[model samples]
Target: MEELLQQLAGKLGIATRFSDGGLVRKDYEVDDAVVRYIAERLGYKAGNRGEVEKSLADFEKRRWQQTLENIYVVEQGKLQFDAVVPAEQAQSFFALQIENKDTGIRSEVAFEVHPTDETYTIGKTIYVKLLVAITNELPVGYYNLTFTVADKTYKSTLAVAPCRCYENPALADGKIWGYALQLYSLRSERNWGVGDFTDLGNFIRMCARCGADIIGLNPLNVLVHSFPENASPYSSISRLFLNPIYIDVEAVPEFKPEDLSEIADKIAELRQSELIDYAEVYPLKISVLEKLYGRFMADRGSDRRNEFRAFVEAQGDDLHKLALFQTLYDIKSTYIWGGWTAWEDEFQNPNSPAVRKFAEEYADRIRFFKYLQFEADRQFKQASAVVAECGLKVGLYRDLAVGVGKDSAELWSDNDLFIRDVGAGAPPDAFFPAGQKWCLGAFNPYVLKERCYEPFIKILRANMNAAGALRIDHVMGLMRLYIIPDNGDAGTYVMYNFKDMLNIVAIESCRNKCQIVGESIGNVPEGFLETLAEKNIYALSVLWAERKDAGWGDFNAPGEYPEKAFMSVGTHDMAPLRMWWFGYDIELMHSLGLMDEAAKNDTYHKREIDRWKLLSALDANGCWPEDNLRKDNYIYGQGYPEGIEEAVHRFAAKTASKVFLAQLEDILHVEKMQNLPGTDKEHPNWRRKLPVTLEKLEGDIAYIRNIQAIRRER
Candidate 1:
């Protein structure tokens, strides 16, 4: 029991003090001594003791609960707390509160649309009016009135009606407005082996030519290091900043000089390649950037400096702190996770005068990081503007990850709002028996509400600022999160509150006029889809995950799909259709040596079932030869067993989803997936380069026509 308590305390980063009677204090108090002790234990420098004590005193005053239940136990030389909320208390705690007149003045205004006074008709259009009644005088201020539908925003004219009510105009159905593309892969000319902004521009042009209204890409979120080999945009260091790696250094106005001939030549060499090689491209780009920075510094102008300073100022203090953290990170190298809790005694106590003085001294270094972010934003916006010039309706749709990294800037800056001792992850399912531990720290539910949901609002505003649409990865997390306590196994975790979460999502989606696509996959609660639909959030339909059971029907069939959903054949996680069909990539298994006896048997059984299904489908379609000799030939063919391509197209085109996305890999006949989940080393994830360069892809007439045909059929 003592050992278990010690392990739990270590994992939670809290010190446990034991008394002679076997009673223990977890030291939930935050103070200089505690902070310094933790920092020293975590291997960070300590600054001053006096400041730490003051900060800790203030922190302890804040209302905090270390346990869900008011109960404690002691055994041997250790103590345990019942942190789990009891059923009786849970019911009362999680119950919804009803609005009352005494508590707050409230009124409900309904907007109704009526074509011919017959509202029940499906084809009839309706106009609605809003009515508001006030019992007391409201604050005088400018209030923005906006309306959103299916992620599209529009403003309604406000008029002082006869009875504080006004009727607005009605909108027609089936109007051909511009549709935004919500999923896109970036393309680059000099992307080590992957696509970049240059490729994105070219792809946007192609999309424009094909009558695509918008092109959405994965998150371009900033990372802590240039070489961590992280491909997920959702797992970023700072949500407010941009990834400098995506910056087009050549596009800078100062780079057009003739003396930069060598840099231009390097871009040319990279453009000729079909794949992106990040290892090679990152170093070369950084070296050229250093040279450019040197040149700019040597001939620095007052105007440029002022502009940079203004950019730094606009980011505000939180961003400055993040920048300072980054600089400290770079200097210490190994202290990537050394946040305030792990810093030296003086620094650990945020209220310390010494820490404040240190921040003042390193202010310039922090400003430099902010300047870098400002430049990145300026360049990316310019790139998007170019795409808009090409007549694309929605230029960029950004992705938002389900959660933040445990040691990210957001967690450090807002530690009180985040529960570091509990991590978010998926529960066990058919796909992964052991479940998944994402190593992400989620926001504390109680704290988030007490703070008026400020954290969520900030994230939403930041992400929507430069995006046409937003895809919430694992969108179900917004409703309920599976939380595993520190040092606890997956089975011991409990579900957190989700009612308030739904309201927050609705408010944000309504506020941001940007369309929302919920990646609603796996273990979703009953009626969750219905609720999302009610909130006007679109559903995502992945072709590979669709089923043809009687209840679910054939998702590939247009009539069977949901009208408000988006359809795609495969995502970055799955193997390309061709590879899944061929089963040629066994190197991943051999390299990782993860294929033990049990795994080998599981793989064999899974593959055999898939093979049988494929053969059955072909036979049912009448594509198989009737004659024994011809049947054998068809089965032994080098390419696909015939009719598979047509089936795939038919499956996608027939979906009832309003929008369909075709992967460039499938169009170009690429055989491997961009990423393989689960194994870090075994999976050659996020490293595969496109088979053809952006230039060559632009010229692929057959590939272009094939996609055009599919779109036309749809």
Candidate 2:
């Protein structure tokens, strides 16, 4: 079993990799069931010893010829492969499909490989090198490489990227101050049940005045509109587009505030809510937006219409496909349905005649969908401009989710680029013992290259536009992803060409003049940080995770944090700073039944010790918040400690890290966390609203003090 497993692992490149931290190999279950699962995932199976031997033999015969990922440098290219056929029959002609992404000039450049008179033996394959010079200029973007040899076409991809990321001007000092927030959770006097770009604009202006360089946000990508209850910012419906729910209806050009006398009633009703009622907000906003779209269209003046036209044209087939998908989806499902999968077969294919007929018949409806995106873009761009005018450096920090839901516009539009049968997930990291299935179908590396990463580039450009910095959630996904088969309980790791991916990220970052920050946490692969550093991307540093000793791990010195990191006290998935300080997370987890009896007790014991170390660090900086109780008094049995919130703020602020980001929850000391991972309906995920209104937040004394503390640390 061991010998067979090793043989399979070597052939499939499915060996164990990465850790929850910088060290420790990730745990993988390789039982008979798991072995079979891996075999099935890799397109092989062994029923008995005799069959296993035959399968092993077959795998060895074709292992070299099967190219999972074909990688090459920009312009200068190399093609290496193992061929089972006669070397003389390998007459290779490389056809490079280059798209000048910036200018939109696409042309095919073909050339022959050098020294084609090469035959291959059974044991070894031949290598071919090519200087792929183009007659036309090509942008630093992904391209398609097609190689034809012996009457067969070998499909591959060409990824073009610069050496490093954008030269960040904000790196003058080692420290920067920022505030992290979930945009939808924000409450404002003007918002309609949820925070809009208008609220974000105001927040940006206020944060700038309070000496903040950036304002981090949850993923602003589009979530399920028809299925509002499935509102998770991290698990989005589409990562390529902005959410229309966040659009400020009042900001539209056709919006007539005076004429909205009747609609004003619903707006006020939504604003009065504590938790975001997505159901109410969806209908109310969509109805209003449809009215706005009608009004805007009635005025046949093509100036705004021309802008919309340019946007559609610039967006290419994607915008049209998304608009059509939404139109078709609305026609099929409504109110509570989760996805667009149940639609007609003709509608399923974006290019089908049924789709064309539906699109033309419901042209106005489709335009309304396009108009919604346009308004979102306009308001978001305006808010970003406000960030700059208000003098914030990395003004509106954006988040890019790791992947999208299986039934998403992204997958629907670009079905060829993803592995549809399986979902992407993480192996058992230190946190999730059973591992985590994100329920997202990520891009297939081979197909991603085959398609020249067209969908990927669009997703990146859309996110980078109108933002100062982009935070790539689960950035480790670029290096490798655990792909779970539909038939398997255990998943196998599939490596990505991160060298090319990083290069592409660098190119996009530089093009947008935005800094790239990667959210890499829990069982990181060895040298992943170095890869990010090579691309000049920043890392995420959570206060609770950073420890002193490698043994049990205590808090380390603030000055010892990563030079290029966004230092923060808490993450959305974890307990807030106040909860950590009081050891309430343990109690909360206990109540939630997240841990076993032994695990719970052990966690509580370790947290108590870590709490003391945290307090001592706060005391050393003279930032301890207790009115009378100090660290010494607490360690030596004080009566009680209070006001530790202020101490926690200052603790993160004093870090010599590149950035100190204080979440609005921690700044205002909101007791409840934004999310609790591994639990869905048990907790109110992505629906919590801010305790204070945006208007009140600007003038809040405590909030002001917290921001000032962070700035002082910077």
Clash statistics: count for each candidate: 26, 6
Per-candidate TM-score against the hidden true structure = 0.69, 0.85
| Residue-by-residue lDDT tens digits, candidate 1, 1-714 | 244333333333343431111112121222333334333222232345443344343332221221121111111111111122212222222111112222343333233211122111112322221111222322211122233323333332111111110110110121011222212234444443345555566666767776665565777777665454655566786776777767666665445456357666666666555444556666676576656555555666757767766877777776776776666555545653544456666554344686578668876566556756776777777667765588655456677888877767777666777765667776555455566788787766546655655567677767876565677888877766655555554422223334445545544544454667789766566687887776566778776556575223333344666766667777777666666665544435544674565765566555545545545543453433444223333333344644454445545655567556666666666677676667665565665665655566657764565455466455
User: 529 in model 1: Cα distance from truth in Å?
Assistant: 1.6
Candidate lDDT scores, in order, read 0.53, 0.73
**TM match of model 2 to true structure:** 0.85
RMSD of each: 14.8, 4.9
Q: Write candidate 2's Cα lDDT for 544-565 as tens digits.
A: 8777565367676777778788
lDDT of 2 at 244: 95
Model 1's TM-score against the true structure: 0.69
Model 1: CA > 4 A from native = 1-194, 256-280, 294-307, 334-361, 491-499, 550-556, 585-638, 641-647
Score residue 37 of candidate 2 by CA lDDT: 55
